[model samples]
Target: MKTALPKLEPGYHQRYIIPMMRIGKNGNKLKVFKIRTMYPFSEYLQEYVVGMNGYNTKGKPNNDFRLTPLGRFIRKYWIDELPQVYNLLRGELALVGVRPLSEARFKELPIDIRERRIHYKPGCIPPYVALLMPDSKGNIEAERIYLSEKEKYPHWTDIKYFFKAIFNVLSGKILSS
Candidate 1:
């Protein structure tokens, strides 16, 4: 939590932490805190980036120039996501479940998935990590699979997926983006 952030221009003061809206439990929107990994005001350029490079396999805008060099490193290591521990503590997230998605990304999901997702808390460790398929389509399918199992056995499903995700990460089968 004490890691140093890169400096912006001399006169520009950067806010190292940012809160982004994500779909939360029961389809409510909530602010989830994250360590900043982009230049200031970069959120305003979402459409521009998408227009230029479009979403990648992971459904993120490709060649997103809004990212700072340090930001890229932070994202790669998931340092930017560390602050979500606060969200977890606040009961907005679970240890294992589908990932919380931004409005744009959430809309891209199929209607059924979208409907089911909101019924459960988003998770820190999503199914993609355990499945080792870190792309948009894979993520949705993995979530569908997970959700199905969760419906049958909620607590047991979480326990199973948690260990799988942990093992995959520790074994270098998956890396955060």
Candidate 2:
């Protein structure tokens, strides 16, 4: 689905919304829509940024200079992720499950986790939110736990995690990163 995008202010000259290639179910790649939250051409510098600063506890590259000031604000509140609803509607994503990892990040996962991950659709709310573990290590552990439980009780697991994540976000116990 394509829509007309308004021109953003001077520093934010990229299109308002952008398509990101994310790993999806069955190890396929899909275009995920998200509001643009970085300066133009930021995608080209991802490797350099990650190499120099490394990933933060939240698994995002540290000292990312590409984020526009408005981008930072929108990301802080997850407004930048709103356009992902289109993906959800298209059945490429779930309301509650793991966040789709970028190609580089997906490659960093353990072999078993990577195998397990491709079996399910990526979600809007990740397991880390429900588990209250926001660090990189905790994030992986949370996903592992979630995937294990999901294997036994797919629907129930998503239902439980969804509510828990909602509660955590609502109560301010877990802030979006």
Candidate 3:
């Protein structure tokens, strides 16, 4: 007998919605909101896809077939991330903090980094937005700097980073990937 595929909810294919849950501070699980940028079931293929396609400078799978043409446009202009404002309002995210990771991705991080990340809420704008890292290591380092500075100056650090990220985005120095 053939197994039946699960039915996607009405408007799921047409509307913006996060494909999966993300790991949040204190080990909480939350649904991160994003415009659906990939083909159906792409979430299940993340590791395989990345391994096959290799990572881009921004650390995303390069030349990924999963992305639709519209998705690419949305990502280029950072429109795909607009739904994350809902996550922010819901208290699952902040205006500035480390980007939330998927469970699989979070587990791949070093123990110390994971520990540091779990200490604060995830953010809509990642630290790399301000620094424009060229690789995953640079991304990690940027997050490390942000998290460390946050510990020393919680409010001021976020405020500073928030403005910097806005500046970078507006200047076209950073685009969501």
Candidate 4:
């Protein structure tokens, strides 16, 4: 048996400052910072891959080949997301809420859900951490529940979900996908 080599050279530095964007509150478009975790040009293939592979409940595609080995580890521990702290500092994101979606993903959602999601800023810790859903549909449902509760409880809803998401991360009950 022969082992395969990586298609591209290892890119530790390239991973540090990749620029991406996400849908923000009121449908504002925001540039989000992240460590690059996928193969070069992976973003261009997102739709094709998602169509074929389908997203897990967490909204990650199953058996994604775009991820490099280091990327996988980075994603598992969410090291890839560290740069998004800048987005938080910029007030484009909350400590707890739904994960931000790309324009393509956002457009794929139902109109009503899209309207509801855009009502609040996206979050660093998503509702999925609290609900632990089994599929993308379940993740959507979790977000719906969080959004509804947020409408009723506002600060308390975020505070409660924030703590729950933290506990889940610390205990390794949920991980970035």
Best by TM-score: 2
Clashing pairs in 3: none
Please give the lDDT score at residue 69 for candidate 1. Answer: 91
* Stretches of model 4 off by over 4 angstroms after superposition: 1-15
Q: Relative to the unseen true structure, what is the C-alpha lDDT of residue 48 in candidate 1, on a scale of 0 to 100?
A: 72
Among all windows of 10 consecutive residues in model 4, the one with the lowest summed lDDT is 5-14
Would you give me the overall lDDT of model 4? 0.83
- Best-to-worst order by lDDT is 2, 1, 3, 4
State, as a TM-score between 0 and 1, how close model 4 is to the true structure.
0.88
Give lDDT: candidate 3, residue 139.
78
Residue-level lDDT of model 3, residues 27-78, one tens digit each, is: 8998898888888777777888777887788878777899988889988888
lDDT per residue (tens digit) for residues 1-177 in model 2? 965545545654456988887999999998889898888878767878989998787767888999999988998898988999999999999998877988887888899999999999999989999999887788899999999999999999999999999999899998866
- How well does model 2 score by local distance difference test? 0.88
Q: lDDT per model, in order?
A: 0.84, 0.88, 0.84, 0.83
lDDT string for model 4 (1-177, tens) is: 965633544673356578676889999988888888888778777888899988875668877899989889998888988988998998888989888989988888878789899989999888988877637787778888999999999999999998888898899888778
